[model samples]
Target: MHTVAVLAFDGISPFHLSVPTLVFGRIGAGRNNGDPGGPYEVEVCAEHPGTLRTPAGFDIQVRHGLEIFETADTIVIPSWISGTGISPELHAALHRAHARGARVAGLCLGAWAVAASGLADGRELTTHWSSADALARAYPAVRVRADTLWSDLGDVITSAGVAAALDCCLHLVRHDLGSRAATDLARALVTAPHRSGSQAQYIPVAVPDAADDDPIERAMLWARTHLGDAIDLDGWAAVALMSRRTFTRHFRERTGTSPQQWLLLQRADRARLLLETTADTVDRIATDTGFGTAVSLRHHFHRILGTSPAAHRALFRREDRVG
Candidate 1:
C-alpha cells in the first residue's frame, strides 16, 4: 500500500487535522458494491510524536515521529500556526523525503513550512488568499496563483485554504486510484469529490430572513428557478411584492447579498454546471444560462470560479476519461 504521512503540529487547526484523516483513513474501505479497496495507507506523524494538544481543546496521541517520513510516498503538511517554524531535524527529514521523490503537500498555511524547506522553490502554488501576498513576497521564485483553490507542482502540492484541502486530497485520491473510488469516498464524506482546484471558495450560504416574512422564501425559490433569465433587483422586488429599497434591505437580511449580486452568482453557478457536465459550447452556454455572451460568461467565470469555461471543461473531460 502507498503510505501517506500527515505532519501534525501543536496549535494545528482541528479542521485541517481532520481533513487528511478523513480522506486517507478510509482509503481501502468499500463504500459501494462495485468500489475497489483503497490504495493508500495513511498515518499522522509529527516531529515529536506523543500526546499533542490540538487547537480544538483536545489532545491526540501520535505514535510515529519524523522517522515515518523515510517510508512515506506522500508527506502531507496541513495548515500551520502563525509564528511556528519547523525544527532543523524535521526540515532535514522533509528534505530527505522529497529527495526520494515523495510527494509533499502543503495545505493552506502549511505552504509556509514547505517554502521554508526550499521544496517549493520555482514551483507554482497557492495558499490561503489572505496570506498569498506574504507567501509571494517571502519566496519570489515560487509562482503563486492567488485565485486557485490548490495547485500540484509535480513533487509539491499546495491548497488555498482549509476547505480547499479536501479538494486537494480528493484530487490525490483520484490520481492514485480512480474517479470512481474518489467519488465513492466523497459520497461517504458528504462532499463534492472532484471540485477543480481552480473553483472559487467564496460561496455565501443562504441565510433566513430575520423578519420571518413568507415572501422571502418564495423570492429565493423564484431566484433559483429564474437564474437563466436577466434577474434585476427591481424585478425580484416586484416578484416579492416589496419596494426595491425594502427588498434590498430584506435581501441582505435574508441572503446576505443584493439581489443583483445573488442573481450573478446563481448564473455563475449555472454556467459552472454546464461547463462541467454538458457538452454545450461556451457561446450557447452563455446565452442559455443568461450570461448573454461568451465574453460575459468568461468574465463571471473567472470572477466567481477563478478559471475559464474552456479550462473547466477540459479538466472535467479529462477526469471523465480517467477510468
Candidate 2:
C-alpha cells in the first residue's frame, strides 16, 4: 500500500488537519486508468506524538512521530499556523524525503514550511490569498500566484486557502487513481467536483449571485455531455434560455471564468483523460474532444499543461511514470 504521512502541529486548525484525513481516508479502493494503484494508508505524524490543542478549543491526538517520513511515499503539511518555523529535525527529514522523491504538499499557510524547506524555490506555487505577499517576500525565488486554486508540479503541490485544499486533494486522487475514482470520491464527500487548479481562487463579482439556476446547470450538463460538438458562447446562452450578455455574466460569477475558456478547459481535460486511458491516435482524440485537429490539440495542451500530447501520454500511461 502507498503510505501518506500528514504532518500536524500544535494550534493547527482542526478543519485544516481534517481535510487530508477526509479525502485520503475514504478513497476506499481506487484505480489508475483501469489499473489499481492499491489502497492508501494515511497516518498523521507530529514532532510530539501526543495531544495537540487546536484553536477551536479542542484537542486531537497524534500517535506517530516524524520517523514515519522515512517510509512515507507522500508527506503532506496541512495548513500551518503563523510564526512557526520548521524544526531542524523536520528540515533534515524533509530534505531527505524529497531527495528520494517522496511527494510533498503544503496546503494553505502550510506552504510556508514547504517553501522554507527549499522545495518550492524556482517553482510556481500559491497559498492563502491573504498571505500571498508574505510568502512571496519570504521566498522570492518561488513564483506565488494568489489567484490560483492550486499549483501542482506532480511531486510538489501547494494549494490556496482553506476550501481550496479539497480541490487540490481531489486533484491528487484524480492524478493518482483516475477521473472515475476522483469523481466518485467527490460525490461521496459532497464537495464540488473537478475544478481545475488553474481556476481563479475567488470569483470577481462584488456580491455573490444565485448560481443554482436550473437552466444554467442544464446548459453546463449539456456542454459536458457534448464536448465533441462545436458550440459557441451564443449557443450556450441559448441553451440556458438567457441572452448572451446575461449568460456570460452569470457564468463568470458562477465558474470564475469566461464561457469560452471554461469550454476549452473542459475539452482539454477530456482529451487528457482519453490520453491516459486509451490507445487512440492524437487526431482521433483531438476530434473526439472538439479540438478539430491535432495541431489545435497540441496548441492547447502546450498552453494549458506545458507539454505535448505525446509527452502527456508517455508520462501518464507508462509504467515508470510520475506518482
Candidate 3:
C-alpha cells in the first residue's frame, strides 16, 4: 500500500483536514461492487505530536510527527494557518520528502506552506480564490491560477478553497485508483466524480428569472445533447435567439469563458468520460466527442488534461486490475 502522510498544523480548518483524510482514508471501502483493498495507508502527522487547535474552536490530538514524512509516499498539507511561518525544520522536511520522490499536495490555503517550501517556485499553483491575489503577491515565482478549481503539477498539487478541496482529493484518487473506483467513491460521498480543474472557481448560481427563458441555459442544454455534432458560435447564437455578437458577449458574462472555449471544455469532458468508461478506439471516441479526428482529439485532450487518451485509458485499466 502507498503510505500517505497528512501534515496538520494549528488553526487548520476542520473541513480542509477532513477532505483528504476522508477521501484517502476510505479508499478501500468498495461501493457498487468495486474491488477491495485500497492502495493507500494514510496517517495524520504534525510538526509536534500533540493537540492542535483548529479555527473551529476545537483541539485535534495528533500522535505522529513530521518524522512520518520519511516513510510516506505522499505528504499532504491540508491548510495553513495565516501569518504562521514554516520553521526551518519543517521546510527542510518538505524539501527532503520531495527530493526522495514523494508527492506533495497543498489544498486551499495550504498552498502557502507549499510555496514557502519553494517546491512551487517556477510551477503553476492555485489556492482559494479569495486568497489568490495574496498568494500571487507573496510568491511571484509561482504562477497562481485563481480561476481553476485545482492545479496538479504531478509532484505538487494545489486546490482552491472549501468544497474544491473535495475535487482535488477525488482527483488524486482518480489518478491513483481509476475512474470506476473514483466514481464509486464519489457516489458514496454524494459528489460529482470528475469536475474539471479548469472550471471557473466561482459561477453565478442565482435562479434564472423564471418568467424569462434563459437563453444561456437553453443554449447550454442544447450544446450538451449535440456535442457529437460540429457546433459553432453562429449555431449557438441562433439557438439562443440572439445575434452572434450579442451571444458572445452574454456567454462571456454568464460563463466567464468564450463560446468556443466552453464548447471545447464540454467536448473534452465528454471525451474523457468515453475514454474512461468504454473500450472505444481513440479515433471513434474522438468522433463521438466531436473532435472529428484522433489527432484533433489528442491535441485538445493533451492540452486540457496534460495526458494522452491512451495513457489515461491505460491508467484506468491498470488500476482496475489492481483494485
Candidate 4:
C-alpha cells in the first residue's frame, strides 16, 4: 500500500487539515457495494508529536512527527497558517523526502513550504489566487500559475485555495488508482468526479443560484452527457432554451470561459480517462471523445496536459501493474 504522510502544524486551519485526511483516509474504507478499497495508508504528522492548536481554537493531537516522512511514499503539506517561511528542520525534511523519491504536494499556501525546499525551482506551481502575486515575488524561480485550480508536476503538486484542495487530492487518487476508483470515491463524497486542473480558479461574475433553472448550467450538463457528439454553440443554446448570443454571454459569466473552451477542456478530460482505463486505439478514443481524429486529439491533449496520450497511458498501465 502507498503510505501518505500529511504534515500539520500549529495555527493550521482545521478544514485544510481535514482535506487530505478525509480524502485519503477514507480510501480503504468499506463501501456499500462491496467494491474493493483503495490501496493507501494515510497518517497525519507534525513537527512535534503532540497536540497542535488550530486556528479554529481546538487542539488536535498528532502521534507521528516529521520523522514519518522517512518511510512515507507521499508527503503532503496541506496548508501553512503563515505563507511566509518554513522552519529549517521542516525544510530539510522535505528536501530529504524529495531526494528519496517521495511525491510531495503543497496545498493552498503550503506551496511556500514546497518552494522553501527548493523543489519547485524552475517548475510550474500554483497557489490560492489571492496570494499568487505574493508567491511569485517571494520565489521568482518558481512559475506560479494563478489562473489554474492546481498544478501537478508528477513529483510536486500545488493547488489553489479552499475547495481546490479536493480537486488536487482527487487527482492524486486518479493518479495512484484509476479513473473508475476516483469516480467511485467522488460519488461517495457527492462531488464532481473530475474538474480539470486547467480550469480557471474563479469566475469573474457571481454564480447564479444553483437551484434556479439556469440555462447555462442546464446547457453545461447537457454538453457533458453529449461530449461524444459534435456539439455546436447553436445546439447548446437550443438545449438551454436561449439564443446563441445570450447563451455565450451567460456561459462565460458563470464559468469564466467561453463555451468552446469549456467544451474542449471537458473533451480533453474525457479522452484522458479513456486513455488511462481502456485499450482502445488513439484514433478510436479520439472519435469517442469528440476529438475527430488522432492528430487533433494529440494537439489539444498535449497542449492542455503537457504530455502525449500514449505516454500517459503507458505510464499509468505500468504503475497499475506494479501496484
Relative to the true structure, candidate 3 has a C-alpha RMSD (angstroms) of 2.7
Q: What is the TM-score of each candidate against the true structure?
A: 0.63, 0.83, 0.88, 0.87
Q: Candidate 4 local accuracy as lDDT? A: 0.86
Q: How would you encode candidate 4's per-residue C-alpha lDDT over 1-323 as one tens digit per residue?
A: 78899999877889998898888887855344534555778889999878888878679899999889999999989997545788899988888888899999999998888887889999889899888888888889998888888888989999987889999999999877767668878998899888878778988877677635777778888898999899988988999999999989888877767899999989988998898777999999999999999999999999987789998898789645644
**Candidate 2 TM-score over all chains jointly:** 0.83
| TM-score of model number 1 | 0.63
Per-residue lDDT over 1-323 for candidate 2, one digit per residue giving the tens place of the 0 to 100 score? 77889999988898898899889876633433334454688899998889999899889999999999999888999887653568898899999898898999999998889888888888888798888898888788888888889988877899997789999999888777666567778898899878888788887755425545567667888999989989988888999999999998888887778889999999998998898878899999999999999999999988987789998787666432443
lDDT (10s digit) by residue, model 3, range 1-323? 88899998877778888988989888844443545566778899999889988879789999999999998999999999753458899999999999999999999899989888889888899888888888788888988888989888899999988888899999988777666677878998999777778777887755477625899888988998999898878988999999999999888777777889888988987887787778899999998989999999999999987899998888777655554
Error of 2 at 260 (Å): 2.3
C-alpha RMSD values across all candidates: 6.6, 4.1, 2.7, 3.0
Question: What TM-score would you give candidate 3 relative to the actual structure?
Answer: 0.88
The regions of model 4 sitting more than 4 angstroms off are 29-37, 210-212, 241-246, 276-279, 310-323
Comparing 2 and 3 on lDDT, the stronger one: 3
Relative to the true structure, candidate 4 has a C-alpha RMSD (angstroms) of: 3.0
- Candidate 1 or 4, higher lDDT? 4
Q: Score residue 106 of candidate 1 by CA lDDT.
A: 92
Q: Of models 1 and 2, which has the larger TM-score?
A: 2
